[model samples]
Target: MTLEKTPPASADPSPPSASSLAWARRRGSVARFWKEYRTHRAGLLGLAGLAFIALIALFAPLLVGGDVQSVTNAPGTALEKPSGEFPLGTDQFGRSLLGLLIWGARISLTVGLLAAALSVAIGTLVGVIAGHYGGWFATVVMRITDWFLVMPTLVLAIVLATVMSRSIWTVILAIGVTSWPTTARLVRAQTIAVESRPYIERARALGGGHGHIMTRHVLPNVMPLVLAQTTLGISSAILTEATLAFLGLGDPLIISWGGMLQDAREAGAVSSGHWWYLAPPGIAIAFVALAFTLCGRAIEAVLNPKLGVAR
Candidate 1:
């Protein structure tokens, strides 16, 4: 007796269109990144708070309509409680604390962004070349990185600032130059991994030049790591700048958070019980640094899924 055989399930005859498949993959990546970021509630809150502070900093002149460095007529207004006249109260010199905080935000964020940009650009170049070449070039670059790694960054920065006359650009350039070694090492390691991939071999077989391979292939793949590092680097740069300023090695003309802390220290604000003088700027520095750190960690979890899995 012959039994009737069940027919096997037929697969779909048509495959997904190229455009449709590409769009789907793009959407998936974005959604995954979003989900990973949303998993960090503290990071999100820090980002929001930083955004608010940034807005205030960006619009300080519009918000308070006076020179950030200009002395006000409120000399007798020291330690006034937060009121309509002075929200966040006044410092020892009777300058508006709110104004100072906002202006300081501008300086901190500017230095942070500029230094990060410079470091990332230089580091990416150095890393890509060293990793791609992978011989004496790599050895030399890595040794240079180790050299900087051994030096105490703060002491080096202080020495540089002292020699350079403590200009704002000097501080920014110093931070950016000094900080690139770590980022270079990270990028080189990432590039080494990516350069060994089959696609890189295919590109090489197709006669793609080092410039093309580095720019179009290697750089894009290592960018997430570079970006995460940049965020963290910005925080370090700001802190270093502030520390330099506190040591009287920062730009004297700029009313950065470090400058405020310097003024407070000189006036003995710490012992005077006028917490208003030092507290706001100190909090601003701490909060801004915290924001960058949180954001960096969130991005790291997204980019390095191994870290997430380990957690």
Candidate 2:
């Protein structure tokens, strides 16, 4: 007779891992973010407006001509109302309003982009170094950043522009130099968060150099924040340039939108009901500013899924 029958052993069953579940959740989150963004009305409108402005700025010369900056046509044709010859009408110098607006875009957009770029570059470097290696270096860098933060950006920019002379580069440098503090703080925070991740730890364990860890690992993760900051920075920079111009700090030779507005006010165009002189440039400025705000918000949402979902 045989012994009692033996039952077959059961294979081990395991629970789903935390890491795998997290990855799946992340994928689902991304899918939901795209879906939500696609359906967002403000996001689409903002995208379209931004595209329009960018296109116009990019192709200004082709669209109008370099004549925007030149003083041409009749000598006594200052402040002419909208007519067939001058669609947007003539300024105090009889230069084409349409041309001036288009040309102004070049200068305005240039200042905005250059300032933002400089800020981003400087901020990124400062942030990366401070965040990757903490302690005294972080304290020193952050203290400087705090000093800048305490100083009002617009007023400081104005002072610099006035003191250094009213040139495009002067304004750009002033805005750029002072602008990076906020960006630096933002980037530093993002860098600090990213540096704590497991992949970063792995790189550290493998004896990865600081440069490698920062460039290859940290930067990629923090880049989205930098990019979002850039969009908002463009809007801020443009406004700064306009304020400088309105205060007569811009290049006298350059007929920017703000300059046009200033001249219009001085010429009493508003009192004379010559709305044409002020309306176009004002609308253009508002349009561009609104576009930037919208696009920036949209980009921020897209880059930060949690923020997007919250909204």
Candidate 3:
């Protein structure tokens, strides 16, 4: 039998390169996520609405001219009914309701994003540490979380907001600090479940340190839940900010949707039947909240199949 010459070890066919394998995995993950995401029509619509709002906020100066103060606070044109010059009408301050709405989007979205990010970071860190280590650390963390949970989040946020300077950053800090307990509890539960998996045990057996296992293993698994929570948290933060603004606790210098509402109420727009003044801001707030809610629900459904109902 003629034996074919064996290829030298150096000439042996290499398995797929690590980079290629990683690329393939990433592509597959993205595709799978999109597939799941697209199944919800409401989610797609919500995403579209959110994108539209974000774009408007980003290009507010270009769209409405760079003179925000002039457009928003035209002293002579205060409460001008919708006309050719002002489409959404002017508020009690003579500020173009449209300009206020546009700029307000930037403020609301910024506060929501910053607060959600801060809350998620704190929650994830506490949860991972508590879950990974367990024992006394876990007990202490859980107890602290419970105490926060038992306290009314909105009330606590209001108190914090009251104590701090009336600024966007203060609002963000108040909301983030008050909001993290729920996320911590959620993350902690998920972490505990992930920690009990066989892969986690194997990693521990292989002499993986707490940091290594938590970062490399536990975090990846819990990320979907965290992401879903973050999306939902945005809506909550926005609503909370609106409440504060309506209650006259918001920064006096900034114009926001809630501030618009507050101005409208003070101007007796509701009683005076200036539908344009009250309706625009109220509708904007509701629609924005609804959009976030839809997106968050879709994410939750994708991550947790039990929550996926035909909708």
**Residue 170 local lDDT, model 2:** 91
Q: Record all residue pairs in model 1 with backbone atoms less than 3 Å apart, i.e. clashing.
A: none
Best by TM-score: 3
What RMSD does model 2 have?
Answer: 8.4
State each model's CA lDDT, in order: 0.84, 0.84, 0.87
Report the backbone clash tally of model 1. Answer: 0
lDDT of 1: 0.84
> Which ranges in model 2 have alpha carbons more than 4 Å from their true place?
1-37, 72-76, 270-273, 309-311
- My TM-score estimates for the predictions, one after another, are 0.86, 0.83, 0.91
For candidate 2, write residues 1-311 as lDDT tens digits: 88998898987888789999989998997797668666657777877987777788889989887666767653338888788888889877887788778878877878888999998889888998999999998999899989999999998898898899778899899989888988898899999999988988999899999999999899988888998889889888888888888888888887677888888888888899889888988888887777777777877888776775333
Tens digits of per-residue lDDT, candidate 3, 1-311, equal 89899867777677999899989998999899889889999889989999999999898878765566554447446688998778888876677778878988888888888988998889988888888889987998899999998999889988988888899888899888888988888898999999999999899999999889999999999999999999998998888888888888888788788877888889999899999999998898899999998999888888888975555
Query: In order, what is each prediction's RMSD in angstroms?
Result: 6.9, 8.4, 3.5
Which ten-residue region of model 3 has the weakest summed lDDT?
67-76
Residue 44 Cα positional deviation in candidate 3, in Å, after optimal superposition? 1.0
